[model samples]
Target: MTIISLQHVTKDYGHGRGIFDVSFHVKKGTVYGFLGPNGAGKTTAIRHIMGFSKPQQGIVTVSGLNSWNNASTIQETLGYLPGEVALPEHLTGEQFIQMMMDLRKIKDDTHCKKLMDFFELDASGKVKRMSLGMKRKLAIVTAFMHDPDILVLDEPTSGLDPIMQQRFIDFIKDEKRRGKTILLSSHIFTEVDATCDEISIIKEGHIISSFNKQELLNMTEKVFHLTVENTKDYTQLIQMIESDITFQLISKNEQINELQISCYPSDLSKLIKRIADFPLLSFSEVPFSLEKHFMEFYDRRVGGELPWQ
Candidate 1:
């Protein structure tokens, strides 16, 4: 079942800003990733989903209720960590957690205690004096302490250190195992790649691609960097590829007698045979990376028209 849905949601801020015709759904017990660079309307779209902003056009719903009209109910039930956190500076981290517990009517502090330990957070310091990373941990603890069925996290690991980031990623996997529905917006490809079941890439206020994570994980296409024995081999290789359309040349550097090519596993034998025909030096297959696939949409201008690759 769809736990969260945004249908043709448009919130035009003008001056070429805000989400346009953004449409996607987060199903129950699945982690959905919303990816984009800075100023790409990721936060804008998420705000609509959280009912923090009303869309000028289209519908935003959570659990069959209109998000804008039922904002309070959604906010109360969903565990949300905003991109930009706001905390009461006067309160210590401990006090802040207690305040959130009271607001959520959480009678037990056991889960909260576990969260603090799991994140390795010390809530004794005042919010104003805490380091950015500590504050982030505090936010994460409170946001998830309730263990809500649905979660909306925006740049959830922004201020965390590398170790803490990994911890958060691992926590997300645990949450998925527990059958929590998650909507995550982040620029960190690793987190999305590690945790998301579905993904959407938004750019220039439009969703350029939406796809299943398996599509990326299961991609058979690969890039290989080849170093030939001599200048003669490099020259001949380019001529060989030009004559045969089998191997695609991505780039080359005559200075180092090296070239890059793209091919699938099916063409591995053909590629090896062709390379063996020349004075070979060395070749290595470059592992496919999510950053490369994600950046392909950066230079694109078709808005929401581009299909997922």
Candidate 2:
């Protein structure tokens, strides 16, 4: 079942900014990645979902409860960590944990102690004195310590070191195994690619693409480098070859041609047969990286170009 849904939800900033006609859903027991570059209205959309800000138009609901109107009630089953978390200066890590426990009315301290131990967090230090990474870890512990059914984390690993980041990823996986619903928003592509079940990409305040990992892998092309015996026009050569396969010329110098392309296993034989005509000196196919795909999306948005174009 859908745990959260945003229908025709539009948040206008008057200057023609903010999310426009945005819509998507997060189902129960799944990890949904909320992705886009900075200032792409990801934060705005998140705020709307969390009830920190009301949408200018349309519906935002969590578990069939209106997000804005039923904010407090919806938050009962939700766990959240904002993009820019600011812990109280006067509070120690222990104090902060205790405070959240108090508010949630959690009678037992078992869960809280386990979380701190799992994170190796030192709870005795004041929040103001902790390093940025340590503070982020504390925030994470606080968010998940309660083990809420639904978690909405914004830039959850922004400041952590590599080791800590790995731990956090493991934590996410563990939570998934327990059937927790998660909505993770981050500019870090690999984190999303690694932990999320499906990703929804928003650009210029609009959701442009939503696909699972396998779906994206199927859509993206793997580039190949071909070195030929002679300086021939491989454009028409590869073009005719790709007629039965899938490939495209990325760049060409005198004796070498680089093609950024992809086709299924069903078409691979046809491509190999075509390459046989060129006296193939050396050939190699390189798969697409998650970082490259992310950069492609970011570059398009930065250049103000339509994603589909």
Candidate 3:
């Protein structure tokens, strides 16, 4: 079942800003990754789903209810962590948590205490004196305190330390096991790569690519790094590669006589035969990683052409 969805959603802010024709759905009990850098309309798209903003076109819905029309209901029930958290400074952390519980009319504190203890949050101090990491933990605790079925987290682990980040990642995995639907918007590749069932890369307010994480992992293309023994062999190999269409040169280092080439697995035999003709120092295959795919999109957005293009 589709728990949350945005269809042809557009919130154009002019000057080529805001999301355009964006569409994606988070299925029940699956974690969907919304990948993009800052100012890439990630927050804008998320805001539409949370009913914080109305879209100029298309529809945004949660549990079959229109987001804009059912703003109060959705906002009150959905677990949400904003990209930037702003807490009231005057209240103590304990008091703030209490205030949230009061608003939600939560009588039981079992889950709330578990979240605080798991995050190691010290809510005794005033909110103003708390560090950024502490504040982030507080926000996390509050978001999950009510045990909402659907979670929409925007850059949720921004201020967390490495240890805390890992804990949060683990916690997300646990939630997934418990059959919770989550929509995570983040540029942190590792977190998304580790937790998401499906991922969509958004750039300049457009959904550039969307695919199952497993499909990417099972791609047939393979990358190999070859290091020639000398400049003479390297020069000859470069010529051989340029004259053939079986492989694409990803990168080259003249000083080290190293070349990174990409080709299909079926062509590996041909590559080996061609490389055998050259005097090489070393050769190794580099595994494809999510970071590499993410960088491809990011590089293009920053005015650099894609490696394949």
Candidate 4:
């Protein structure tokens, strides 16, 4: 089931700013990753989903209700952590948490306590005195305290330390296990690669690529690194690769007699057979990564064309 959706959403802010023609859906019980660099309108699109800003075109919905019309209900129910957190300086962290609970009319503090303990947050300190990391922990605690079925987290681990970031990732996995639907907007490749079921890459106010995690992992071409035993073998290998239509040479180093190539998984046998003619020092498959795929869109020269495109 589609729990959250943005249909052809556009929010133009002039000067070529803001999200445009952004569309994607977050299915129930799955994590949808919204991947983009800073100033790519990630926050703009998320703001529309949260109903903090209305879309100038198209529809934004959560649980089938129009986000603009049902802002209060959606904001109150969904577990949301904004990209930039702004807390009341006058209130202590505990007081702020209590205030949120009161606003949501939540009577149970069991989950709230667990979140506090899990994040190691000391909410007794005033919000004004807390460091950026502490403030982020507090924000995370409050966001999940209610245990909402749906969550919208923007740059959730921005201010966290490495250890805390891993803890947050683990927490997200636990939430996924409990059947929570999540829309995670982030620039952190590791976190998204670790948790997302589906990923959408946005750039300069536009979505460039949207795909299933497994589908990307199953890309037809696999990259491998090779080191030849001698310069003669390396030179011959390059010549053979140049002549073969199946192999795509990514890079080569003549001095070290090393080369990288991309070949179809189905052509592995053929590749092995051909390479056997050359003296090889070592051969290893370079692990496929989301970062490599992401970089394709990130590169301005590529014009946002996906590998398959």
- List runs of model 2 lying over 4 Å from the truth: 224-245, 249-261, 269-285, 301-309
Please, what are the lDDT tens digits per residue for candidate 4 over residues 232-280? 8799899999999999999999999999988987788999999988888
Span of 10 residues, lowest total lDDT, candidate 3 = 300-309
lDDT of each: 0.88, 0.81, 0.90, 0.90
Q: Quote the positional error of residue 182 for candidate 2 in Å.
A: 1.1
The most accurate candidate by TM-score is 4
- TM-score of every candidate relative to the true structure: 0.86, 0.83, 0.83, 0.91
Cα lDDT tens digits, model 2, 9-80, are: 999986757999989999999999989888888889889989989988899999999999999898788999
Question: How many residue pairs collide in each prediction?
Answer: 0, 0, 0, 0
Model 3: per-residue Cα lDDT over 161-224, one tens digit each: 9999999999999999999999999999999988999999988999888878877665547889
Candidate with better TM-score, 1 vs 3: 1
| Superposition error at 224 for model 2 (Å) | 4.5
What is the lDDT for 279 in model 2? 63
* Clashing residue pairs in candidate 4 (N, C-alpha, C atoms within 3 angstroms): none
Clash pairs for candidate 1: none
lDDT of 1 by residue, 1-309 (tens): 999999999989999999899999999999999999999998998788788899999999999889999998887769989898788999999889989999999999998899899999999989999999998999999999898889999999899999999999999999999999999999889899889999999888888888887766555567898889889878999888778777789899899999998876678888888888887688898977777778767777746354433
